[model samples]
Target: MRPVSVRRTVTALVSALALASTAASPAAGAPRTIELVNLGDSFSAAFGTGGLQQVEGVDSCDQGTGRDHVDELGSHPRVEVTLDAACAGYTAQEVEDLVSTKPVREALATADVVTLTMGGNDIGWAEFIGTCSAAAEAESGPAPCDALLAQAPARIAAASSSAAETADAIGTESDARIVVLGYPNLFDDRQDSPLISAGRAAQLNDWTDELNAALAAAVAEEGAVFVDVTDRFRGHGVGSADPWILFAPEAGAHNLHPTERGYLCGYFPGLLSQVARTR
Candidate 1:
């Protein structure tokens, strides 16, 4: 047997070596998968994308069926889509209710990221468009459409309030990184036809800008990221020869929504850029 002093010294050296080896070794666990939860209205619900054609009477918007920008996020290596709570035709108020669903709440508890697109429906965008288009068809001056939307300020205020409230509600249940996406302008600025005059188009675009600003302020106040896709959609609005937005009064099913190419190239790029920044 070795001398007691030699043995004790050897033991200390061996123990130190073992600890050093362990410290130098790579960690032994797999990378944690990011759980992503999507919540909001039609934009998130994939509204006009895919090949969803119109049905006679029923809602052509496939509601929860379409896959929107969430699919883009899930394509990232670190992400897994845990819940997609978005639905067609849902307002901000409706989204608040969606977040209250049992599965959605449960998903939020463990979610690493949550993305939302709301407020458009709350501001009654579709109705506003219908009214404005009708005025345009009548060849009325910008004043008629302007007067029709005279109550816009009040409506915008209510939309803003509801957005902030929804953000607060989401924050309460989720510690996840939240992203709120803003809508793009439906009309471009270049040319003006007799119908939907330049002034009228500008007015419509202005309201959309206001809505985005409100959404940005509300989401920022709640410590969430607000992504504006307006610039991304530039040169590709409703009247552009290669418009990203689909617009045909008869093709009501996808009238105001982004086309598949628009979502993939336009919306997806904007969203992915934000995700990269956050990561």
Candidate 2:
């Protein structure tokens, strides 16, 4: 998979650029007045995949519709979607700025389902990367990826705690399904590939496992649902007819953001499952 950490880094950068140009408002008079708010980083912000424009009647944003996840539903739990808000390099703390801060007032207010794929880019993955990178330098070539992979769970746990505060906020409001969408498998978990290095794939997958566990715990504590995307994305692992993986030349394809096919198959399929579970 060309190393998931590296790919996610590229996805983070492009996601930031996309977030800078988009804004989220409210969707009105749709089915059941179900307000769907997507608040998170670039993975949730699909950006120029459709480009920016104004959300009608709200008179606040000009961002396009592509960044919205509820729209990705197609028919699953169908509702009117708001492109909502996405902040690139957005930490757990930054989520408040969009939903509660002075800049965007209605970004996350009174919604039926609020979904996000966040925190990995904000946590200490870079430090893990540095550790892996240094290990590689010392061992020569790709050996450091092993060390980096081992340390992923602890890092994600810490990050999820910080992100959990957002779940807490949603709990306070009682307006939406506080769904925390997790990052998918980013590595092969197998050591036979040249594209990934050493035990690097396993390490990344291990970290993702740890992170998902932490997320599940955090969500349960907050009375929310933590949707596990691991198995689903893994099913689409490289070479599957419905691959959720990012390959080459797809812009941030090297990163963890869903491929267009991944979106159609992975995000939607798994997301629909999550919606069904809650309903």
Candidate 3:
């Protein structure tokens, strides 16, 4: 879970902020604070990162008051937050739960921004991981990995489309900058590549690509922001670029999940910047 940084594609923040110019801002007397509502699965939830502190059954990440985005983005802001409601292995349906169960007034009543990363679990990412791994191991066959990946394009489209609808609905009601984050490399490509093939890496990455792309497209169509972190996570595994995740079989590994280091290195940077953008 310790990483400096991976080979990032570096989509600059200036360009990302320019995309959000139509949202509402806080009232003049209200503190110029960025109230972030992270409604997603584990990644944005700050799970395993020990960054969240729950109060009265309500979860909130450290926003550093006027520096919530600054603490995360390493800069200053009027106010920032690290709201967390991300559950492990969340799906499209679970998103409704995230919003419905929360104290809406506390979390979304004055929400300036919202970030989500869903639909992978909806498409059965865990199943895809196991299946794709097995298929990659059985490389002697007619490329079962290819067949499994074939389903990704359609599944991602359906799941993302549904997710986009939900985001739009919430955004309209709360006037928040709804940002969607894409998944990273969970599978090791070496498994089928004869180099390392740790489990079902290649096929899984390919499928991940499909899901990520679909998510980006959906966010765009929904008029929400898209925060892609796919390429940055490639070297998270053992002997990886930055080793953000512990190769499995180890105890309590955040495998298939973003490591704390990954969070500091890439996730938080890309995310906080988008959340702090002015409308």
lDDT values, one for every candidate: 0.71, 0.56, 0.59
User: Best candidate, lDDT-wise?
Assistant: 1
lDDT of candidate model 2 versus the reference: 0.56
TM-score of each: 0.80, 0.69, 0.71
Q: lDDT tens string, model 3, 1-279?
A: 232232131224423443342233444543355666666665654443433343345434221111122234423244355445555556766675556664753577677777777887778776665555544446645365557667877788788887887676666557778888877776455534322355456656667777888878876887888888866666665446556643445423244565556665557666756764745
Instruction: Put down candidate 1 lDDT per residue, 80-166, tens digits, no spaces.
Output: 888776767778887787677677789899987788888988888876776677455476554656676897878888987898888
lDDT of 2 by residue, 1-279 (tens): 334643454345334323322322235433233456666665665632444444343334333334234454522334445545655456776664455653234545556677776677756554554455334446655545556555666667777887778778756655568788887775454443433444555565577677778877877788777777777577555434444555443543234456555554446555544444332
Which runs in model 3 stand beyond 4 Å of their true positions?
Answer: 1-31, 47-77, 134-147, 188-200, 237-241
Q: What is the C-alpha RMSD of each candidate to the true structure, in Å?
A: 15.1, 10.0, 6.3
Ranking by lDDT: 1, 3, 2
- How many residue pairs clash in all the candidates, one count each? 0, 6, 9
Best by TM-score: 1
Better of 2 and 3 by lDDT: 3
Name the 10 consecutive residues with the lowest summed lDDT in model 1.
53-62
- Give residue 168's lDDT in candidate 3 (0 to 100): 69
